[model samples]
Target: MRRAVIALVITAAGLVPLLRYHPNTTTTAIRATAGTAQTPSASSKAPSTSGTRTVTGSEVDTEFGPYQVQVTFNGSTITDVQIVEAPSDRRSQRIAESAAPTLRQEALRAQSAKIDTVSGATITSEAYAQSMQAAIDAS
Candidate 1:
């Protein structure tokens, strides 16, 4: 009975950090390693037909391995950018998590491919930027 109790305590202690851990720690670590700020060049622009449009596709050759992004645009401006697929590694996941908001905000506001990169995941940011640009390009 004593041994079982000790094992339970150890298991609970081990789980404490994992459950209460702040994801920001990973973001901080990634930022320390990968400097932020990415700007994508302007690709050729195409005319839009009408109404709101959504483009969905995946970019295979991304910095954080294979990633998929879905982009939504209204008229000529992007309204949303969502990460449909992300990396398996924990560090990469955190990077992806950090970049999503930046990607969406910049894409919607800028209405151009010149959105700034995420603080930690420059490559992942670039990949999202490029994929989003491709969506813009397609539209």
Candidate 2:
């Protein structure tokens, strides 16, 4: 009986941490009007002058962080895509850094916001697409 009671206590102690643990449920929302001027960044490419225009997308807030995109169009053809904002947290930053380049390539190839979501960066991908679409629509 005593052994069974000790085992129960041990199990109860193990379960306590689980009961107290809570996943992050916080989310924030940020919005930006389309057609805003591009925010300069080191990663941004030089703007093409011939028949080209740059448009900034609305910022999208996800559980990870805010995401925004800028797209450059050369006479209705998508020329380049840049991430204007992304999550700053370490895990999210790592995911964004790896995913952003692929996402940019997909957006350029697709010429729209209908690109496939990057593996392991689903949230960032969705937010990116949403913002990209907004920019395209504005342009």
Candidate 3:
């Protein structure tokens, strides 16, 4: 009985650190990026949306940090997905750089933000999709 009690104490001791440990994560206000689209000009008042237009998506907060994407449309088709502000952490940056292109392609090809997310980039993928969808909605 005493040995069992000691083993239980050891197990609880091992689990304490795991429960208390917290990884560093960042959260900050969204800032405009170079890729952010500008307001349309008076001359750009098209009866039909033939010209390209860009829309910024809503900021999404994820485990690593805040992320946002800007989407551009050529008429009704999505032509681009720009990572206006991806997660600032190094790990997130690497993941984002790799994921952004694929996300853009998928968004363009799908003509929507509802594309299959990259396997290892769940947080980035979700933020990308949300931001793209926001742009599409704005259009």
Which order, best to worst by lDDT? 2, 3, 1
What C-alpha lDDT do the candidate models reach, one value each? 0.65, 0.80, 0.74
lDDT of 1 by residue, 25-131 (tens): 22211121122212221331345655576675445354345566677666666777788777687888888887788788887788766788877778787777766
lDDT of 2 by residue, 12-101 (tens): 999999999868776544444344534533333444334777788888878767888888888778889888788788888888889999
- The alpha-carbon lDDT assigned to residue 53 of candidate 1 equals 65
What's the TM-score of each model vs. the native? 0.60, 0.69, 0.68
> Which has the greatest TM-score?
2
lDDT of 2 at 12: 100
Lowest lDDT 10-residue stretch of candidate 3: 29-38
After superposing candidate 2 on the true structure, give the runs of residues whose Cα lies further than 4 Å from its correct spot: 1-22, 27-50
Best by lDDT: 2
Better of 1 and 2 by lDDT: 2
Q: What TM-score does prediction 2 earn?
A: 0.69
Q: lDDT for model 1, please.
A: 0.65
